[model samples]
Target chain A: MSIQISDPMLPELYKVTKIQENTHDTFTLEMVPKNKTKIFSFLPGQFNMIYLFGVGEVPISISGDPSSTDFLVHTIRAVGTVTDAMSKIKEGQTVGIRGPFGSHWPIEKAMGKDVLLIAGGIGLAPLRPVVYYILAHRSKYRKVVLLYGTRSPDDIIYEEEYQNWQENFDITVETTVDNTDSEWQGHVGIVSALISKKDFSPTNMVAIICGPEIMMHFSVQELVRREVTWNDIYISMERNMKCAIGFCGHCQYGAKFICKDGPVFCYSSIQETLKRREI
Target chain B: MKMLKTILENHPSFQELEREHLKFVIDNAENIEFKAEELLFKEGEKADKLYIIQSGKIAIELFTPSRGSITIQTLGLNEIVGWSLTPPYQRSFDARCVEDSQAISIDGKALRIRCEEDSKFGYELLKNFTYTVVQRLQRTRIQLLDIYKIRT
Candidate 1:
């Protein structure tokens, strides 16, 4: 594999090409490299270091399709100082783009196998690319199911795309909201609740799970109970990713640097690491 | 009407019982039908029996003086509702028909008397109800999380 790791200390300039507001506090930004040489590629589960001119940087997942090389897409929720500023940045503005770092979901190994994508809240953004990839190569995978849970109907993102995906692809999309109004006439429960309701061959299924740490923990348990092996289950871990490269120690888990080693990992690889009480 | 054999083999609450024990309950069961907007039983009324939905929808509702009646859950085929036949023997929610529905109602008093006679069979029903209770509990807890609240 010819791997070209980018320089970590400095970030390249990327101009915001398009902007779309998702929710009251979340927005999606499409950026393209200002310098032709900085037009880098990334896998489904990798992340980018987004930097505002004066403020610091934060890691946001690449939420666009791999096959579509026009622009890099990221769905960001304004949570802290850096993200809050990035969310406010207008279209056509230039921002710093760094390495599309970390490992990705086993989309390759999942060929001819059933795929289950379980996400909670903002966790759905990172997994969006996987859905795009499977849809792009529909016949390569056997079945794809997306089980997503949010706080309520209003909190759901990509509502239009979900409708399109279900109608167009051979994919099953199930969603649950924690709270619902009378207007919301759908499943009201945790995302994990939908696991047993769906039909999939557990032995032949590869599950990619993301969300809050607690949600991921519970989802892994549910998948295991349904006979999905830990080896076939992958999860994306979120941490304080300061340097897109491994040098900054902020994103260390056990002996691995999340920036360099993974944002995606097989459950078996991190089982013991998650079990540790605290560091 | 759906057959007793189907209920014995597939009802969410009673399907796990041994055939002999399940047969005894099936003997006491009666199939009931309701039209949309009709009541199965009102909240606070005597909990006469437990129901295993055979078809259609039954809404478990709570009637508040202010909000009137609000549906808590709408249960359908093969799902069980009304476990009030257990200890309290008092209906907890007003179960009403949302869509024309059919269910197998097992007489609570007779079922309780039967349980007293057969402790092993009673234990099986207890286990089944526990599962339903836990499922409801977990769903409620998820709602309590109010997961969609935009964090600042």
Candidate 2:
């Protein structure tokens, strides 16, 4: 059942070992080869183009929490054919795997700085690794704050992880729903409102954001207004990714390939692409 | 009343509304309070009112039995909540009061009647509502693109 595309480097025979449904229409697949437990090491923000036999392939961010390197994980939402196939993939089914590729979170630079992590909807997948890395190296960063927003209480991904993050003493976590829900007991507003209410100084803060482009743009603007310099902010951009290598133009947004050149990038570097609505 | 005035003064849509038209719309609107987790309206229900948040949050939910319910969006204070004039003219979706909330709402039936009585104000209101829906639709399309990749 392995149909090789032109590229030989992209591995097509990885296997799924665990599956956890996160919410309606979304699931996280924990994968490894049925033949072995080991998988390739990846950067904190890298993604792999996952293939599901006849269903085709789509780019997915690695969602393995950094505190423990258990298995390669991807939190996927069933939006199109490829992702729909992904949702049905059960443990023991075979799925394709490609590069643990792309620029990673700058873990070294964030050391001793207050880290602000902002995510919208399912955009938290890309930031999950960064959270893991920070929590793993707990003493390195002074203060960690995670701000997340979703369309509703049901749409929030990683429910258990969210609770753990909320309870962690080393980190301050705030949640917001675009509209509130009966079970949503916290704030009910845009994530930007949470940023506004926090007393964190952006002078010593490094902000990383991923979500809808509009949300990222707005959150970045809010962070800037709070004195977070563009140099200190990082964001993950989403574009169609065909090749994890730069050869495919699908993931191009300006000069970068979100799969290869990024998936994670500094705000100071990608300003030009950020302004273009199409990209 | 002060909260209503301040919210209207601060809202972007009201910024350019003619003073007379603004006052007219405001005078026609009345505040309604809902108990926690109350159903404002259900999908396919008659479109009878348009709402603006005064306080608390409202969740616009879309439900499919197999997949369960997903919150499509949330509307908060100072945000407009429905497009009662839009096609289907019935509620295309469901809105639920997620918390004990207060909202300023105008009767759609009365507004439509008044709009027929005076097309000028109707035109302005409809123009604003259409623009807001278009902007939100564009944002939703992109957000869905980024977040959803269904395997075919």
Candidate 3:
């Protein structure tokens, strides 16, 4: 979605329509614009700044299907102040939302090429919309593969959807956990291990990764080792974003304001900055 | 024997070995398979063999008092499964077949003798195994970080 800059800083009122508990610490919130006719639209990878009254706001990626005009969805882990408050919000309550900000996954660029998505933990939240978009336009891509890794079996998000995607769609979904007991009958290892399990034309693929910085670091190393170029790899980066626009510099990484220049960045563009310590 | 040799040649762990060294490995190797849910080796048992997985899955697990067998890693096609190649060599974790699986198992005793007799061959194999060990170590460290945990 384009930046809604007419009132970029102002938050539109949206009401919590439903709240689904996804895991012990994570939850998915579905909100509809309080104004009956207002439409909330976002492209995959864009994030909305969710404002919970009296508690403050946090930037959360839009996790629902982009085609659905009814409500905005965000899958959030209750990590800090605002999100902890957000976790307690019940259905029918009101919250403020601004934007659909930042650049998005380059779905058009991946038209004829294979799309590889690597997500770790809740990092899958931002990439879910991309999967939805791909399933909606299945023929545009070739050999779509998603490699997701989380802490354990219980930590996996969208577990039911994984089954649906595997059974009904043309895409390939491979999941692994960092560790698991015998009760879990799936792969147990880092997400990077799944990269070699599937064959994709590295030179003819677009890889998008969103996860812990270190996990992304190793995954990129593995992809590059497999001959995928940095130019074709994209990563969604998170920083402490205070303002959704470029004006507030709280989320600056080197010379770029993450709020404006990214959330999603081509690895080649930020490779140097990404390697630097404490930017 | 020829098919097994071809499989060894392609395996990442043995791909770098010289022709003679490859022959030595092939001579010491034998085809082995395990049915689903079969135990390959348990922790504290003699680490007498190394397997180059040809098909299916093997889970490297640790038996804990409270949690039962916890799988730390899973090995599949073209992956190496055991590497306890030092003195007092004993399996550090339980290796169990997650499915019907096949592998080329090398007799560790014979392999060790060949390595002791030929320093060059020994170095080559050790180097390859070291690379695999290092990669596993890196992955283990990443897992230990619990990088997925929510940061406050």
Q: Would candidate 2 be rated incorrect, acceptable, medium or high by CAPRI criteria?
A: incorrect
What is the alpha-carbon lDDT for the whole of candidate 2? 0.75
Q: Itemize residue pairs with steric clashes in candidate 1.
A: A151-B148
Q: Write the per-residue lDDT of candidate 2 for residues A1-279, one digit (tens) a residue.
A: 111234535564667878888899889888765446543566688777887778787888888864444467889888887887778777788877776667777778889888889988888888888888877788888888999887767788876776676577467877776654355566655676557556676788788888877788878877887888999989888778786778868877787777777878999999887788785
Tell me the tens digit of each residue's lDDT in model 3 across A1-279. Answer: 364545878999999999999999999999998899887778899998999999898999999999997899999999998898888999999999998899999888998999999999999999999999999998889999999999999988998898788777877888899877638877889999878767899889999999999999999999998999999999999999989788889999998988889999999999999878887
TM value for model 2: 0.65
Sort all candidates by TM-score, best to worst: 3, 1, 2
lDDT: which candidate is best?
3
What lDDT score goes with residue A142 in model 2?
80
Question: What order do candidates take by DockQ, descending?
Answer: 3, 1, 2
The TM-scores, one per candidate, come to 0.88, 0.65, 0.96
lDDT winner between candidates 1 and 3: 3
Two-chain DockQ for each candidate model? 0.39, 0.08, 0.78
TM-score between candidate 3 chain A and the true chain A: 0.98
Q: What is the lDDT of residue A212 in candidate 3?
A: 94
